[model samples]
Target: MPQETNIPNKSILTPFNVVAGIIILAGLVITVLRFTKGLGAVTNLDDNNPWGIWIGFDLLCGVALAAGGYVTSAACYIFGLKRYHSAVRPAILTAFLGYALVVLALHYDVGRPWRLPYPIFLSPGTTSLLYEVGLCVFLYLAVLFIEYSPAALEWLGLKKVRNLIVRMTLVLTIFGVVLSTLHQSSLGALFMIAPSKLHPLWYSNYLPVYFFISSIFAGLSMVIFEGTLAHRFLHHKMDATHLRESEGVALGFSKAASFVMMGYLSVKLIGISVDNNWHLLFTGWGLWFLLELIGFVALPAFLYSLAVRERNLRWARWAAALSVLGVVLNRLNISVVAFNWYLPSAQRYVPSWMEIGTSIFIVTLGVVIYRFITTRMPIFYEHPDFRHDI
Candidate 1:
């Protein structure tokens, strides 16, 4: 049977709920306007900038941050890091929601949302990186669903079914990692087709490598960051194992993320050096690139190192937040900011208020769904009947 949490009935009118309600309502209104009024009514995207924040922030950033699912699960099941097991559930849940929302965000971005499956199913574009990304995302989303199903099954007291899924953990983890690696790198590869459009400093033959490496730290930082939030708002929901291991998970991930960020920074320098874009570093675009590399990447890596050295959870949390921001900054720089660097300010893509609102709406929706699931499921705790199995 599942563990029962003594969750008291709470008011439905809390500040968070009220704000989320408003966002959801606004999202619905925008949804109506978007479908009826078309992309033009809700977005600033044009032929010059067919992709805006919807692709940059929501899709790229969302997928990168969501890498926690594969990272955490791989750490736990595949790498024999059993101490981090408590985090696997929440990480998987976050990734599942993140990918689902990514697909939803695509619907809002495309001219015809209904035709999303056409390229994948009806006429497979095997030669396109996009088709590979689409196929991987589709397959990986299913993999995450299966990875996440044990919690839902356990919550519903389906012991046999839950145990069956649990037995396939290793297989699922391997598959998830393979799929995640393919798509994470492929996303960066998508930008490689337009070298002339993307700024010289940001463009490199190693874009895929950069993206994959950054995602490693991005996923690690997100796990730490999400764990912090869970501990704050949902502390009472956690079992002893989750609560006790939370600090260790944070510290361990901090050390790992710090090292990965250093590697990422090194590779980024190599990319610039290989391309011999040293002269560009003296210019304004180079300054912006350096800021992202040094400020977001290097700084957070140091912070994570400091946190791990001192065994300071607070510093670890801060580093996680900064690293998450760094991933977002990198994705945005590639997809929006740096993509059309030569264009005049008047011609650049700037997301409309409605577009931004829709993003907020999608994120808020994930939060709400997560809250609902965690509050009900055995996500933060092990079920008594299955405690020995895990």
Candidate 2:
């Protein structure tokens, strides 16, 4: 005799599903409006302020937050931090999704999305920093894909392919680190040409150095942040190793981030002193800058230090969140808030509702995709078949 069992299907009408559906639908509408009516139809971008939150939030914040991939991989593969091995897959997945979304958001910002490949393939702008960013982003996105492919291959039961890709892990990590360094700094260098337009307090010759250094801690903080979220919602998806090592990863990253943030603060001070911008700090812009540095940067650094000293995971999580916000604030200050500072208030750029909605839509898409892949793939846990190999 044999018995048959039937399982009930999960409902698709849950709250998250409903909200995500609405966002996706709205995003489709905005996409149509953007392509049909042009950038003016969906954004507040103008000749004076061609860059808006799309560039500030989508590109700058996206890339900076995605630093977790290189940071985590470098720690594990290059720096030989074996305890962090459990974190590599999740970090790579986040970075891959983040960069993929950055490229997608660019389509909404650029006048000709199709021409994005033109600079890389057809006509390389060797003299332009933008071209360097484009090429690195393109290549680095490919590297992230390859770096993240092992999880997918494992899920598909492709052992040979996954192991082959695993063999190249060290080489890919090094190449990715180099590309990330170049583009992250190049992003800040792009604004150096507009020294007069950017506020005196924010502009400097060391802008590139500031950007690169901050990205290191930004990536570290993001790893902790992502781990916290994953622990909360995706707990069941993680295996014993991930759960066991998660705290260690958080604590170690917190210590590293704390030291790096202190270094970043010191360099920022040196930049001001070198540029002789001390007098500007007493003004309104200076106060705002101080808020960014002190409230966001210094406070988080201190919190991280305390977290590491006390071994408090909760404090580490909070510090990571604040540090992530600091990176976002710094990028927006440079690209949006501080750019065109001398312009009249009326002429300044303010994002339209549609622009904000589009950014939300893109982020929601990433969240949805991440949830889908992590649920199905070997991102949060080691596959039983390959446990010994890993």
Candidate 3:
């Protein structure tokens, strides 16, 4: 483990920080225009494209990226996989930031950002999958806050308080996992209600299960991907010993990701064949699905094997990144790209530059907050056995 020292203080004006600030400033300007001028002025959303780049990338991809928290928590605390333990704090921090930004992006995407909290108090529709999603998100945010409390306690110089929080953390960990499982799968269930809108190729009763499984693998892959990025760019801030130890975590993640990828690929094929979707193979959507499966799922699974054998964390990390891109594209295709396939290709409602810029801004904001929290807290440098450490 890394020594408990020299964690960098958060900076205000690194190049990436400056870029994020500028983009966010731009987004705030656009947000003002949105409230004043209407959604039409700042977005490419039509009745057909009610959900666009923001929903596709930030909401969908963001959830996949945030998969780290539940997956790691389950492995370490629930399943007793101690080898995966070090990844937990970082994963929780990643999930918290990712989901928080996703929630923000969602508020921006909705027709009435102001009435967003209505679901919590005024409108509770249990029949609707979105209602489940809303409630779970609200609860999970609290759960993540509790889960991450110990790190803050350590930074606050409150060893006794941190110990108390850590003792109670397992309950929060289990609750967070349960909430994540429900919402992650419920995201796919949101589409199941739109059977008429979704293409037959992508729509199925099993979508929730498929999405849930994919999310598990996606979470593991994301940790590997994020950890590698941290090592590359933030190594100067990381304890060298911590950096070396993290490689073992990376290797374990790759192995687990490959296994899950294989299972995912198998099930996807089984789903298609069971539904007799082979007949749709010649269509554009079919080809796109093939690319998603081969380019993202199978290719990454195969490469990780080589990466594991070669002992190359870089290759493993790259494959994880590729896998995440594939997962993002697949989700986007399901929500936007594939949903309106029957419409003419030219009028397919791609995102405007404004929407793209805002999407980038939201993710950048998530990354910045994640960096800020991890750097100042005891997350990366050490695990707190409060008594022993103090």
Top-lDDT candidate index: 2
TM-score per candidate, chains pooled: 0.97, 0.97, 0.92
Rank all candidate structures by their lDDT, best first, as comma-separated numbers.
Answer: 2, 1, 3
Tens digits of per-residue lDDT, candidate 2, 1-390, equal 122222222366778888999999999999999999999989999999999999999999999999999999999999999999999999999999999999999998999999999999899989999999999999999999999999999999998999999999999999999999999999999999888899989999999999999999999999999999999999999999999999999999999999999999999999999999999999999999999999989999999999999999999999999999999999999999999999999999999999999999999999999999999999889999999575
Worst 10 residues of 3 by lDDT: 1-10
Order of candidate numbers by TM-score, starting with the best: 2, 1, 3
Stretches of model 3 off by over 4 angstroms after superposition: 1-13, 383-390
| Model 3 TM-score, 2 decimals | 0.92
lDDT (CA) for every model shown? 0.93, 0.95, 0.82
Q: Tell me how many clashing residue pairs each candidate has.
A: 0, 0, 0
Per-residue lDDT tens digits of candidate 3, residues 324-355?
Answer: 88888778888988887788877688888888
Q: Give the runs in model 2 whose Cα sits over 4 Å from its true position.
A: 1-10
Q: Score candidate 3 by lDDT.
A: 0.82
Q: Report the Cα lDDT for candidate 2.
A: 0.95
Candidate 2 matches the true fold with a TM-score of 0.97
